[model samples]
Target: MKGRSVILGQINGLEAAALMVDGQLEDLLIDSSGFAPLPPGAICRAKLGRQMKGQGGVFVDLPEGQTGFLREGKGLRPGDTVICQVAGGAEPGKALPVSLRVLFKSRYAIVTPGAPGLNISRRIRDEETRDGLQALADMVMEGSDMGLILRSACEGTEDGEIVEDIAAMRDLAEAVMADLDGAPELLVDAPTPHEEAWREWAEPAPDEVIEGDFATHGVLDAIEALASPRVDLPGSGYMMIEPTRALVAVDVNTGNDTSPAAALKANIIAARELPRQLRLRGLGGQITIDFAPMPKRDRQALEQQLRAAIKGETETSLAGWTPLGNFEMQRKRDRVARAMLIGGTE
Candidate 1:
């Protein structure tokens, strides 16, 4: 498949990544200049500053005003600032590339392995009310600065892990506090890509897995260890997946087939593969798949064949094709698809 390529880097304290799909500039990933110099576990405040137009709270601005989202809540007024951390660099023109948190410190860290919407945060508040509980609740209710969010690494983690993470954050916070006037650096560790994927898949099970051509054996081995069967596709047809401002498109073609029926068969095979692709690739929102046209007699048979192939593959519901020969469907968007595809574990 032919597509552009780009480099991801931190440019002037902002999270910036360049894209060149198909050898063309597809997009550029950029976060706030205020969010420059991102460090793992470092929490920064995002405010609706005077230069910005939207109401204050947590504002995730996108290029060309596409895929931008604003979240407002108590303690997040037009002028009030909310705490956020650079979860990681997001793809260009994507919404909320950076993850935001209401509280800095949490008690229990929630982790979702390999699942897109998987979130990791510390739980600060407890329902059970007692002397210490009341104090902790008050701190959470008041939004104290001492709290820090524990990431997905804390899932099924022993108390020792939580304590160690908290201690690390405390020490880092102390250093920042001590050097109030100087540039401070805090080192926060993020989970490995494999660990993150494990967490997501652990959340919602996958029936089978298809490994990418470029994926490393170690990566595949790690995923396979999680109990999902893996299969490598035959090197015949090729696919190009592009995520645009409007929707995501998957184009398929018989790159090497010579038979007349080969294209139709390949199209049918590709269509059948869509559901699994959507799950494994996490392709959400409106998705369009353009494949080589099939013969009129084969159309319905191909549709049924694809449907049967993808039955019960994911949470997404697939509809039959329209009269125009277009198959339409929607996938849930709990988290960003690029995060999953590009291999990020948070």
Candidate 2:
């Protein structure tokens, strides 16, 4: 309850994994209950469809009459079959976003077909470790045409484990790339929430790993708090995260604070907390934040705070302040919403 804990459980028959740090929910991943036409990270073979003309993308013919939209459609024509990976989660009744640049990713390595290179993650600054990893990559990828990227997780990992991980992924990529006879078929399925938690959250091992039910670890309560409209911030402040049809609107407020700097304090707190809030809630796309009333001079400082908070979030992009004095951002949809994951639908 007071340290980093990884809780795995089931919600409405779907799988879920939650990460709690110092009793606060840091991250959450809930299974999509197979509702997603193409879950994130899914690789498939699809028949290319004609361009939409106005959308700057073409439709892909997925299995079971499902269609995916690929934004990069250069040199592709109707009836041509190409391999693609699910770019992100799909919107309700919309085409699943797919990318022509397929990548095979794992905890320790990423195998990129059609690309050729061997590199190490920049996070691992130890030159000795990088050289050893590069040697291992060369050994395993000697004859391979695809690119091999050793992830940062390889920093302290054992050589045997890293070798095996790279080999397995290399084999998978080779096998999948050769499967050209399929008719709009799924080649690889996405990892389950619990499995992905293990794959991604192993860098800084959690203090505890609770497997089984959620009630024992108070995960249910944390999830319930996320389902609420208001998130209590520091200094008795709070913010309401409301997802409307067009965009997610967050309204911050300073509660019962008459101090002169109350607005700036609350606004800074909101900037620091909004990333995790939006991430855990699985809210994406357009986001508009109306912070507590503060001086225009403080906006730059608050934006700096917000940028620092979301710098590591690859799917989030800070769009800067709008003319209406609201901060706007664009986040790529990477997972199904909490509503759909917990309740199957809104």
Candidate 3:
């Protein structure tokens, strides 16, 4: 219950999936139902709708009445049509958007049609590896208009494979563009959460495993796990997460342990799990964590650990501990919650 978990389910002809960590469902996955599948990274034709006054982005009407926003209008008007890709899911409470900037991703590389340049993943730290990958990317994109971002997985891959990957993506881009006039619908679906998680991490942690009886489980089972905000810790503590209009509140309690050491232990556990919980639930806006009270030095250590735990998140920030020893954090929500995605939000 303290590592990763994967689940796939279907209900009412809608297929859904999820990824969980430490018994908390973190990422939600859903398949497109009608018209055509509008998966991320698939390019399609879209017509511009009315632009929001004072807002930089413009809304567009996607097939099937779903609304998508373009952060930059690129001079497109209400009636003008343009090609766009399903860039990503919408932020919590916002409609999904498409991007004029299209990217095709392989295991080792990300090929961009709009922005042509050589880039490397920031996660790759070794200078020599970065240089090698950059050089390889540059070589592959030598005369092509497409840009390439070399992922960490490309570090040890041969030049031939990398080149072939880039070329394959370029070909896919051409095919998508070519079919735009006749179909003008979604081209392909992005990898599901399960696929993305496995591909990026190579493998889940040793303890990670698929949950539920796959043969009998329904989508509701997965949805329920993701919708709830309460999670119990390994030994004798539990966390309750409640979201208010202004902020998300998380309270940690030492359920059965009363010793001084027990308090510290439970607090540390809560600190480690809190960030994962935030990510799993996709709760955003302001966040406040209330843990069992402890000394200043211990609290400081816990804060440092929490900071280290959430370092990978670009949109999440941790403010220093408050006077009352609580922690405050802010995370930008950019994906719909599972409950809302399934029309089960209350």
What's the CA error at residue 293 for candidate 3, in Å? Answer: 5.5
Ranking, TM-score, top scorer first: 2, 3, 1
> lDDT values of the candidates?
0.43, 0.86, 0.67
Which residue pairs in model 2 clash with each other?
none
Find the candidate with the highest TM-score and give its number.
Answer: 2
User: What TM-score does candidate 1 reach?
Assistant: 0.39
Over 169-202, each residue of candidate 2 has an lDDT whose tens digit, in order, gives 9999999988878699989988889989988887
Candidate 3 to native Cα RMSD, angstroms? 5.5
**Clash-forming residue pairs, model 3:** 26-280
Predicted candidate 3 versus true structure: per-residue lDDT over 121-223, tens digit per residue: 8878899888877777777677877777877776666878877877777677667655545424556566654555555553333354454443342325545
The candidate with the higher lDDT, 1 or 3, is 3
How many clashes does the backbone of model 1 have?
Answer: 25
Output the number of the lDDT-best candidate: 2
The 10-residue segment with the lowest total lDDT in model 3: 211-220
Candidate 2 local lDDT, residue 50: 87
Misplaced by over 4 Å in model 3 are 1-43, 54-56, 73-76, 85-94, 98-101, 122-132, 174-184, 193-198, 203-227, 243-248, 256-267, 282-303, 318-336, 340-346
- Model 2 residue runs over 4 Å out of place are 344-346
The runs of at least 3 residues in candidate 1 whose Cα sits more than 4 Å from the true structure, single-residue gaps closed, are 1-44, 49-68, 71-76, 84-237, 243-245, 254-268, 271-286, 294-323, 328-346
Q: Please, what are the lDDT tens digits per residue for candidate 1 over residues 1-346?
A: 1333324343333343433334322232333323223322334444432223354334432222322234444344544443334443334544443344422333333321112231223332333322333333233324323444344344445655555545544555444333323121232333323333343332223332333321221232222221222222354775566665567677777777778887677776677666655544434666776666666777677767776875655445566566776666666543334333343321
